[model samples]
Target: MTDTDVLVVGGGPVGLGAAVEARRAGLEVVVVEPRAGTIDKACGEGLMPGALRLLQGWDVDPPGRPIAGIRYCSGETAVSHRFVGPAGRGVRRTALHEALRRRAAELGVVTVTGRVDDVEVLTSRGTVRAAGVEARWLLACDGLHSTVRRRLGLDVDPDRPAAADARRGTDDRRRYGLRHHVGVAPWTDLVEVHWTPTAEVYVTPVADDVVGIAVLGPRGTDLDAAVAASPALARRVADAPVVSTTRGAGPLRQRSHRRAAGPVRLVGDASGYVDALTGEGLRVGWAQARAAVATLDDPEAYERAWRAATRDYRVLTAGLVRWATSPARPLVVPVARRAPRVFAGVVERLAR
Candidate 1:
């Protein structure tokens, strides 16, 4: 009588992740996405060590891409650290979408390539009905602007949605996402963070002979502007050649706040969001998927797990964003550069 046991709305990283885990847990999952091509959401694509291990729980091994550790450079100091077990993996957004979509197929999650016109939460036992498809369970996994979050009134407000919950600041200081691929090799074994007066650029060695840069800057500044401002990164890529296009995720007032309402649940950027500063967005999504599947037996329990896995990261990420954006380069640069042990310690704790 229904299309599937669980209807996952959206085909982004989180949605695919939810679908994958749901099917693996024996739930008949259906993913509804409106887009025609690969759903490449705006992101700085890097899976953290915690996320990579979580993938193994779902029988997903990260594609064989090498990620050394972390290299951080701010105003006065620069530090690089070698990675521990399964440091992490970096894949482009488009490539990750495609690979996950393919994996979803292997997992037997039904893919519906269309948008939902409407949804009705049937009152009987508090079931979720979307576009006449009755799902024993429902997942928002849609994204920050999740329609499910809105429909269920689980978001902060009727008109505001998730706009009022996250930390905000003066518009004069803005943050934008910028990504560019370079045609160079082995910039080093560590992921690099180059900080200028106005912005911070993260360098990821994702592919065989290429490195990806995701820089966050002010509203008027972009990837091109970041490149111009940072002679260090520019010279490193001078011979490497620029490959990926510049991209940005417009700063929004709120992130998703609803993890579940009745049988409905949210994941990744859908339930809430992570600032690009953490480079842990994908891991957050994957971790939520694991939690969601475990909680599927009872959506309420799932929400608990989701919140537990994310609460610290969300708070930690908020503080990190402030630090990354702060003008205290002298104090920040030295810590980020010379003493990666502190950062590594923080990361190890987060992974656990």
Candidate 2:
């Protein structure tokens, strides 16, 4: 077997970032992913200021439209917040992936294209083995519904009573996301979140002339229906050409019993995910990647670091998601409108 210091499963942004970090630490790394090229996913496409800083540190910068801040709208009530430190960016998923991939390649991170079906090989030996390579540590950065998380028995079944009790209603409301790009000039610098009764439609400017629209709600939530419900949103995109096909991802909530199992450590969504409502996935995942590599020798330390890294995202996102799904959902925008400072504080916190 080919020996290496680390093996990263999945080649998405998080996985690639982990590989880059490991290599920078003087560790030989190999990444195994089934996908051949830069991957794309359904996401809000906004990179918080913090996340952009992290990418820049790694010398991986993807070009995109500047995002001043966030705006929330519900009927006639609207509230906006400008980031205090730096502006964020709305980059297409593929562009971000390509940037990360290029950075990894620059670091001499070897990527093998194949699915890892045998989880035993990952945790059986002191040196994890898979995809014809052996490594001292395995980091699973796979996205939600990760096979690595499941096969290693790190996944927590939200349906189980014990899990439900521990997670406190994580499985109660399952939400999914759908995204598509439209060929229209961005009208606003701030990311607009149009809230409807059943779903929230996020409009992000990803390019000079391309805007990405994403819908988040129940499983059957229709993108067109959500847009149509918002007269303001509909008017903006009604005549715009659809630039990309609809992409989707779902049942966004995922939980892990623990982040580490033997030499295998779960990173990014594979470790656990609260919800994407806060638009903090990339930031949180990038932080987890750094933590995972830094604490490779001590799984417990990594666990602590992981928790610390994701604490804000978990608490704030979980609370917001709970409120968004509850009967008080209608009050969200109004509350923000009334409490502008609170809204700005929350937005700045997330942006940071």
Question: In candidate 1, how many Å is residue 169 off?
Answer: 7.1
Candidate 1, which ten residues in sequence have the lowest lDDT sum?
A: 157-166
Q: Highest TM-score, which number?
A: 2
Candidate 2's C-alpha lDDT? 0.90
Candidate 1 residue lDDT tens string, 280-302: 77777778887887877676787
Lowest summed-lDDT stretch of 10 residues in model 2?
164-173
Identify the candidate with maximal lDDT: 2
Off by over 4 Å in 1: 62-64, 157-174, 338-340, 350-352
The TM-score of predicted model 1 comes to: 0.88
RMSD each, Å? 3.2, 2.0
Compute each candidate's TM-score over C-alphas: 0.88, 0.96
